[model samples]
Target: MPAAKSDSPGRVRRIARLIFRVCLFGGLAAIATLVVAVLVTMASLPSFADMMQKPNGQTVRVHASDGSLLLSLGPSYGDWLPYDRIPAEMRNAIVAVEDRRFYSHPGVDPIGVARMFYVAKRLHDEGRRLQGGSTITQQIARNIFLSSKYSYGRKIREAILALAMERKFSKAQILELYLNRVYFGGGAYGIDAASRKFFGHPGDKLNLAEAAIIAGLVKAPSHYSPSADAQAARDRASVVLDVMVDAGTLTPAQAKGVNLDSVTFAPEPKQNSVRYFTDWALSQLDTIVDEQAAPLDVWTTLDKRMQDAADASIRQNTPKDLQGALVSMENDGAVRAMVGGTDYVTSIYNRATQAQRQPGSAFKLFVYLSALEAGVKPGDPVVDEPITIDNWSPRNSSRRFLGPIDVRTAFAFSINTVAAKIGQQVGFDSVADMAHRFGITTQINTHPSMVLGTSDVRLIELTRAFAAISANGNAVTPYGILKVSTTDGTVIYQREAVQPRVLVAPFVAAEMTDLLQTAVNVGTARAAQIGRPVAGKTGTTSSNKDGWFLGFSSGLTTGVWMGRDDAKPIPGLQGGRNPAQAFSAFMRVALQTRPAEKFATDPTLPEWQLEPDDEAYFGNPDQGFGGDGAPAPEAQDEVTGEVPDVQPAPGDVPPPADTPAAPPRAETPAEPQLDQRWLDNVLRDQKRPPQSPPRGN
Candidate 1:
């Protein structure tokens, strides 16, 4: 049968050649299409040729008013480092883990592309995230221009731009750009910032392990940042070390010998050390300086020494659960120091400037001042006996009430009954008006209890009021950021202190100062004495929910408040306790460097005398309750359950400070029947001395 005649060798060769030609043609067509696509993508990409020669972007460096670094805001980049300054270890570690064939590849590694697809398929089947397969150049392209969203178009553009980059710059130049631009966690935009943020050092100082850790972060900055999670960073570094060894950039023995245990992380980023002040200043920045107007120098009015002292005092003295706030102002209303809370990091709530807590008895200043405005003298008789106004009854901090006390003694001891009676006599509207005139901006409810300090006020407003009192009734508007200028020395904003306005007669404030001095000298705020003459009042809510001390020397006014954010009572807390102590502690340090000063006093006034009846107000300090006074009322407010310990709640009174037996309910003094002529003068901001030679005496 011709032995199944096999085809001739020539015929077989011809058929094999035809089949090979067809396959080759198909491959050539595919290559040509890809090249054309690459060209089109390259046409749209920007020039990377001279990018390294030009500045990337500028950062907004923030400085304290004193010219010290505070924190930096953004242009989304950090200091650019030359390639040589960046440690070799840092660059090598990056190359090892990110792209081993980086130097040899024209731009993109086809081998890497294959492995990426293999891993992607496996991960997709397992329902895991598809990992990035970008080479270093491709990553640079994406970071510089293209979007990160996964799509064929992005990948194509990224690859074409990477090829373009390869042609435009050397390997070192590309790596330099990469290190200077890639984000490395924190608010860091590049290696320099990342290094400083995590290690508290610069890029040139990075050790092998540090470099490896940084290299590891290229994959996921936030998740593996040493600042956020040291363990995660360390583990990732180990992986990077292994990759380095496999890439021949590091030896296995060397990698094994590296210790990650000694690595220390920087404190949490933006852990806002001075958040309250920073926030306030930053807000002002918007109005005064254009955020985009280059860098600026903001000179704040803050005294660093005072701020530190206040922060420490609040932290060390207040109970952990109990929050505290403080604001210290110069007599001219300059905020020298402020502490918004125990921790600004855990919470950014600025209690000193933002919180509107009841001033407690601290608020009695307005009531007493109002009475003074109505022609009531500091020595005028003020009955502290049991008094009921409508449905409200007020008592002293100590439950026992002294029968009849002078207005000065009543204010010094923060007698709630006397203050409430005074508020009633002068009219609640008048008292509220006085507070508004002094600096309070929060709404004031004109209920009878208002005199007991049930009205809400910000710590800053109340502190400024004390400043006004110290300045002899001249109202001061508190201010920070004294001046702001451009980095190049162009003054953009300058704060000019306005001449203080007269809120009350200078002599009236002076007399009030003499009366309040008694508080720190022998009454409730005794804890606040700074060994210098201080005029201030103590305030505690009936529920012990808020405690406060507002005081001032002739030069500085300081106020402190301690309470729970939720307004819950802190058992045993009082105005004379932590709040007063903190104020004193802060003042002791704040005033240590300054000349000791005292509040101006009007000695010719009867304010210095203590009546025997008022002496019974606080029974002998040794023996608790002494006088036969009304029993202390309940700590809870009858009008509202929100009893701030600022003043004695209706039922809450001073314990047996010596007092006479419950005196008959005194008739509310008819608005002092002042001589119409004298009254008209007082209402006109008269500064007459409190001890004037008699109108009728």
Candidate 2:
């Protein structure tokens, strides 16, 4: 008792004063720290009042040429909404579940703050994570202005910013900001977008049931959203309705009537085929107008029916590993259909628009066209006879020559020897020039092998060349966009129809068609017959790596290419098999309803006489043309391949796998001179072509 007694009243008083001074100092330091923190948070914020007038996310839509929607690209982050535009049900449901005393609070709810402190203490004691109890104002402050980090400092900043934002904006504006800027679910930011995305209707159209469902999503959009889980979303919606009924926003009877099971859900998006075409057309947009100037309304030239046909044909005809491409354009060069690949999901590489592959024997068309231009008649006698040009000795694909076959016959058979000779006789310059004038922008190889289609080229250019022939020599550059307008219907860019430049004379094209029709009727491309006269060529590259069937009908021209992406050889796939069959199938489907029109050409051959097996390839080209049946220039004597010695039946016709491949060049002291000398002598011998071995020998 004596030890517990106070030493003195004066000493106790001194101790009390010391303690008071220390407490006062500590309080002052804490106040100063809080003041500094408030200042720093104010410094970090932007002018919130001015930010209201600026735009939020903007969406860009792409449409097919037919005005059907393809896809939307953009700032799909969220769509903006005004306070008045929000439905009462949606707004009340949110307030009831998220913050009941939102209107009465200054910037933060003191009751919520105390509850969070209790939660923080209990969670810390349990070694678990703390949970948020933020008011709507504080949430808006954090999402719109402050970083989402949760720390003592960040919490302090959030409170300061919330108070500041509340003072600057009205309660209604703050609520509008919260509802529009808050993350709802499924990449949606705001009740407006969430409502539209999940219900397929606007936010203002939301009913009590929909509003409760959307409000429930605010807590965990991905977990509770109907798009992800139906049962979870319904459970959450029920909880939200209970909260609403407790808050007096909904009566018990109303809550009972609001069932999530009866609400309609949005349907899944339909698949789009025009995505690739629109992508390309948009790129071309940069050249003419800035699509950024306004929301664009692009109209393309894609024919939905033909596009589907092309896609279906590629899938059914080509192997899974071997990719294929098809591009079809009208004679005037308007791209009507394009199938970029079998499946755009696995690959976005537009083979029709972007891939460049060797056209193989397809290039021979250009070579023969040059020969035709140089006054070589379609019936002109050309030797399939094997002859050595220095080290480059060319042989026919049959490995056995048909002796002196006419140009029309050689072309129908895709004979390599005669093609190489034709390219040699005309000089490679004329062939290259013809290609350039016809819209082949890619560089052409000047070698003699160019005639055999050894060089790489895009399918578009090759298709364009064939289009020119179909148009009777009118040059065409493939174009897709027909018109581009703004959302207000003001035309930003309009493509006017203009007559194209002519590349070949009308008669030359007709003569070329006359020969090509024979190819489809009785030659290597017999598989491509569509019950009409189709003019085209079949091209198989060396090693069977690339096969092509580039052909045209009366008004439509189509090109198809098939090959491995790695350029490896395909087994037993020649131009006559897969490519030809695909081309025919695609054409049949594409023009199934359109009336069949014969090709517009003079001097056409009769279909019944020249059956696929008809040995009467003996009917002269000049005779069928109803022309001054000019005597074909004689072909000079040369060792073509070994003559088969006897006529083989039509079924025994060997595929001209390689128009004669260039045998290795012979080594000679005067190799270049010999090359020049052979070229010079080819045309001279054209008038005296070696006579064919007697038919049926």
- lDDT by residue for model 2 over 1-697, one digit each (tens)? 6655665776898999999998999999987876665566656556655554333334456655677866665434445678898888888999999999888887889998898899999999999877678888888877766666778887887888877666667888888888877777766777767877788887778899998898898888789988878789889999999999999899999999877799888964544445667666677877877666355667788888777777766776676578888889998788887777767766888877788788877887898889877877776666667765546776655455555447776777677778878888899888988888887778888887777777788888899999998888888888888887876888888898887687877767877887777676556665565544578888777667887888987588999898888898865446655667667667766665666565555333322133343223312221221011111110111112221212221222221222112122211111111144554554455556433211110
lDDT of 1 at 680: 53
Candidate with maximal lDDT: 1
Error of 1 at 299 (Å): 1.9
Evaluate model 1: give its TM-score: 0.73
RMSD of candidates 1 onward, in order: 10.7, 12.4
lDDT per residue for candidate 1 within 325-356, as digits (tens), equals 99998888778888899888788899998998
Instruction: Candidate 2: give its CA RMSD in angstroms.
Output: 12.4
Clashes of each: 32, 22
Looking at model 2, residue 339 earns an lDDT score of 74
Top candidate (TM-score): 1
Native-referenced Cα lDDT, model 2: 0.70
